[model samples]
Target: MPDPFDPSPDSGDRFTFGLWTVGNPGADPFGPRTRPRIPPTEIVAGLAKAGAWGVNLHDNDLVPFDASPTERDLLVKEFQQALADHGLVVPMATTNLFSHPVFRDGAFTASDAAVRAFAVRKAMKGIELGVELGASTVVFWGGREGVETDAARDCRDGLGWYRECLDFLCGWVKDQGWDLKFALEAKPNEPRGDIYLATTGHMLHFIETLEHPEMCGVNPEVAHENMPGLSMVHAVGQAMEAGKLFHIDLNAQRIGRYDQDLRFGSEDLKGAFFLVRMLEGTCGHPAYDGPRHFDAHAYRTEDVDGVWDFAAGCMRSYKILVARAAAFDADPEVQEILEHNHADPDGIGPILAGFNASNLAALEELVLDPDSLATRGHRYERLDQLAMEHLMGARS
Candidate 1:
């Protein structure tokens, strides 16, 4: 329910999309074998050419956590220069907390204090890079924050370790005097049986307890929500209503399965469409300051280009949804229907029955139309015009 007459903000019109590239571009999915790699600079250029507003580079991309100082410094310089050359901004970056063998037990959640300390150091480095690159946010995905076995786990100590790490990181960022928001991306279970913050609800609880309103927020990935048998649109709507949706990550959800990171609209098209509409109808016109975060696993062999294509399509889809929602808003007859529905829910059947076949046909026509803007224009303006004409003649 946005104001129909309000001018769309520049930020809303400029839809930003991000690319998530962490691991080997051509690494085997089922095995640990690596293949020939593409340069990260080429990836950045490709994304910029494909109409992305920014990129989400991982800490590992800057320098593998275990690399020598010389190697790390060189890699960081190369990435920073490439981003500048391509006019790509880094809105967010993540720590490499999962890939190292030292994190087999966990990184921040490890029972060993030394391991936990090492993880914190790595995260601090990543945060520093984010600040240096002028990123708006930094993400911490608890990749190893889970237990494979219930019998041998020290739940209390593990939880304590995680909180400590988060508090320390937040405090460090606050001390820096940066306006960077720290986002916690939640997943039900992957790489572990139960992640520390497994759902939006869990994340909310943690944020409330932490009480660091300026430092923390949730980044709900669409696929992750579906993995836990929750509706993505519903979950996002709940977050929006509660004023907790600071950012979002778009990917297709495989019904009743783990995170797939498939192309947008690949599996649950209805859900995807609704999500686009919700984002537009709510966040689009107002101009959200946060980034459109992405957590895409490289599913296609084309590597970087494929990732960009998917991200671009997602942004385009959202734009189309926004335009359509605006059309619906401009239609007086449609507004009347909505208003009447609000006033008298039980009276809807009789009113709906009046148009019956024609109404059903018009809906199908509008939804199935190929031309995006034209379809919306016809459905909203034309349908309302026809309805108004009929109503006036009947009254006469």
Candidate 2:
């Protein structure tokens, strides 16, 4: 019989990693790089060997930021050969608008018109690269699109500039007839004092205001959401509910800290279990069918072997969480509690379904005992304890 705890991943799992993630050199703001850089080709080979379905990247992750046209082509050709040789694929791509000094102020929201134009132009090239690599989604992480103070630029102008940039890019993609979509990643702060569209919910609402709302979605990172002491599961659920969860970044982070980007399911085990349940729809709902991309890196204290270990651990943790979540949802006790909590014995659902004279009348005529309702315990404590047991392998 197959081991229930087996952690081996396969292509069918839809697991992916970013070149920048696995290839990260372990550099932090307080120290120099501890690990040597791993070339893009080598990264691809390693990921395939690790049983990853696909890889992702930023424009600068493969080609140099200052490389000439000929150099860029050669680099891309070599990377493509490596991917083909290893049976790996590119699922997503992004731009590095933050790294360059040109975006010191901001990219799309830059006060300098030339800087904004250059940012858009660079995004166009990044989009072309992504489509060429067969990526259906391009993520935009506006790392520097914020201000240290309100005096830097008017918030209204910044929003208008951002809108214009996205509108232009959407039109460009449509004109080229490329099968691509944009996933905006949000961060409360880090590279900047405060970032625009600071959370997944904010991104969802912002998407609706875009000229090509349907062509835009959000890429929620676990670490990014947790940095602000928010619930990653709720953020993701909102995105999924709105049908805007185009892509996701699986990693861990401690609350009230920098973006740690630790291994998946490392810090918030309970949160991770719920997140897996939501994504896999183990609790009875449609699952999110998208690449489970790990946008994380190894610790600075590790060597090359440790890096690979970190990679494997991320996938292994996710698989384990998935199994646990399934077990939790399938538990008979859990099922009973959920059914009881969700029981609409009074049949108030149909009446509350819409707003109309008849429905309003039905709702108005409804008789209920508030004291009885308040006195009835939901048994959430028991349900939560059951979940923990499942997650900890205490119950199966």
Candidate 3:
């Protein structure tokens, strides 16, 4: 048998990593930098060697925040050359809105008008860089766009300011005629007490109110959703259903903890399995065709080699789970249970489809066995157990 975990270049997994993710210097809140930073060119080469299809970045990840124009041009040129030499693409890009001290309070939602203006300008530059590098998606993670205390500012004002910024950026993209879309990322709370639009569901609704709603979407992260104990699978499903799943961040985290950013499939095997099933369309929905970006970091204890190991592990784990989900869905018992559960003997599909006059009359005339329906078990226990068995390699 062939090696299932092979990170072969021809593999269909369009896995990607951010320059910041692999180049993280093992620094955290308590400790100083443990490893030296790797250059963007070297990071690209590493990712390509490990079988990654593309790389992602924050503007500052490649060019320093205060670099002169000449310096910025040099850095970008070098990085682009590295990408060409290594056969990699830049799929997504974002701005570092949370790292600088000027964004201490917030970026787009900052109380200071000047601060908000500066944030928008910085985002414009980030968008230009993304377009220059041929990225089709730009993600916005409002890491500090919230408050520790509700007394800071009215959330209504914050939301208005947020909407203004996104609307302005959407208009700017339209003027430039770049084939780019904005993806808003959500986080419950970490750097701040509470972040506005704190979940994928919130982002979805917010996008609808945008000036160019069609060009906006949500980039839901596994760790961000899992931090709040939300189901990542459902969150992605909602985005997919709404035709807004433009990108995704695949990482693992322990529920109710700080953003762990663990390797994919490390902590929650079952969740990851079903997530793969959904993304691969093993659950009967169309598969999502977007960059499977891993916005995660290696353990604080890992060195340079371990960082590469972590990157490779993420891609391999995703591929392994893909195979497992396919096998689980193909199992005879699993299909039978699903078919039986979905059996609509009363022909209610069209009646529930809409409230037409004839459909309503048919619905009113339909009879349901209330007592028997309430007692009919879904056999989900057995189905869930089988899922676990497949995930655990206990079943073929």
Candidate 4:
């Protein structure tokens, strides 16, 4: 059986994992601040042990967004020391745009200039800290960049405010010479009725309009995508192809519920497998410049360990996906389908007809024959055996 952990040429280069600890140690995602079960250091250590490349830290996790300079400074120093002690690098950090009540109207898109300025100032401080901590990217998920009542508000003006805010924020980052990227994560509607950049395509269009190479990019979240009835695989593919897929936020959701950041692979295994394929098979090999930001909502009550377990499960699922994709690609029938589809789009009708009537039966046997040497342990082994059999006659 093939080793699922082995890295292939197409495997992802920078294996980034995020720690969404904004409300950790005490605070739950919804409410009720519990006692600290595990310290932050242990979480970092566990991530490193689990083969993660880096960690994503949120602004609140490091310090209160509205803290005094002296307080902020102390917290910054503490965060830096924590990272150094654990040998964990922060690839990204997000502003505390969602925690405070002042952002009810919106953060960057607030109609009130005062609120907008405060939000920007908060984000700038977070960016500076992220730079200090050697983070590669600063994420901006417009938690409040939406409209609850569009009837009273001028939609165009609101959108204009958002673009202006992004331009200003992104420009500041570029001027800092921080070698950092700005990732904008989009969610359809949660805190607000209608999010400004609610989809990957919408993000792409916005980024193109920004025209700042270092300014903006999309961080597509799995559950976020699924919530809007979008296919995760297609979304990832589109982002990759557009050269705008700057970061990734992985999590699962209940098919049609609110953004539930469940553990990876918890929902839609086949879809999750395909997402893995898109990440490894396509996005991994390229000189893809970005981060894999985990925007997870801590679903379990165990706190830190639960988050670590979720991250580990994500990695394991990634392994399964890569293995299966490799095997699928190796199959002659699959290859034939791909080639025919690519070479002659109209030829698919005739090409598929060439397969014998018993082919489905044979394929089923190949997939389910437990005693078969190929049907052993890992999913990779089974897939590889099936592919090999398809490529080299079944009798062989």
lDDT minimum window of 10 residues, candidate 4: 6-15
Candidate 1 vs candidate 2: the lDDT winner is 2
User: Candidate 4 residues 118-158, lDDT tens each?
Assistant: 98888897888777778777788888888888874687787
lDDT order, best first, reads 3, 2, 4, 1
Q: Model 1 misses residue 134 by how many Å?
A: 0.9
RMSD value for candidate 2: 1.2
Q: Estimate the TM-score of every prediction.
A: 0.76, 0.98, 0.98, 0.78
Q: For residues 23-74, what per-residue lDDT tens digits would candidate 3 score against the true structure?
A: 9998899989888898899999999989999999999999999999999999
Candidate 3, residue 262: CA error in Å? 0.6
lDDT of 2 at 365: 92
Model 1, position 133, has a per-residue lDDT of 75
- All models, RMSD in angstroms: 11.9, 1.2, 1.0, 10.3
Note the Cα lDDT for every prediction shown: 0.68, 0.92, 0.93, 0.69
Model 2, 1-396: lDDT tens digits are 855433334425888999998899999989999999999999988988877889999999998989999999999999999989998889899998999999999999999999999999999999889988999999999999999998998888998899999999999999999878899999999989998889999888888999999999999999999999999999999999988999999999999999999999899899999999999999998899999999999999998889899998898898888889998999999999999999998789999888999999998898888998799999999999999999999998
Worst 10 residues of 2 by lDDT: 3-12
Off by over 4 Å in 1: 1-19, 22-36, 282-287, 301-311, 328-334, 344-396
Tell me how far the alpha carbon of residue 164 in candidate 4 is from the true structure, in angstroms, after superposition.
0.8
Error of 4 at 193 (Å): 2.2
| Clash counts for all predictions | 0, 0, 0, 0
lDDT of 1 at 76: 70
Task: Score candidate 1 by TM-score against the native.
Answer: 0.76
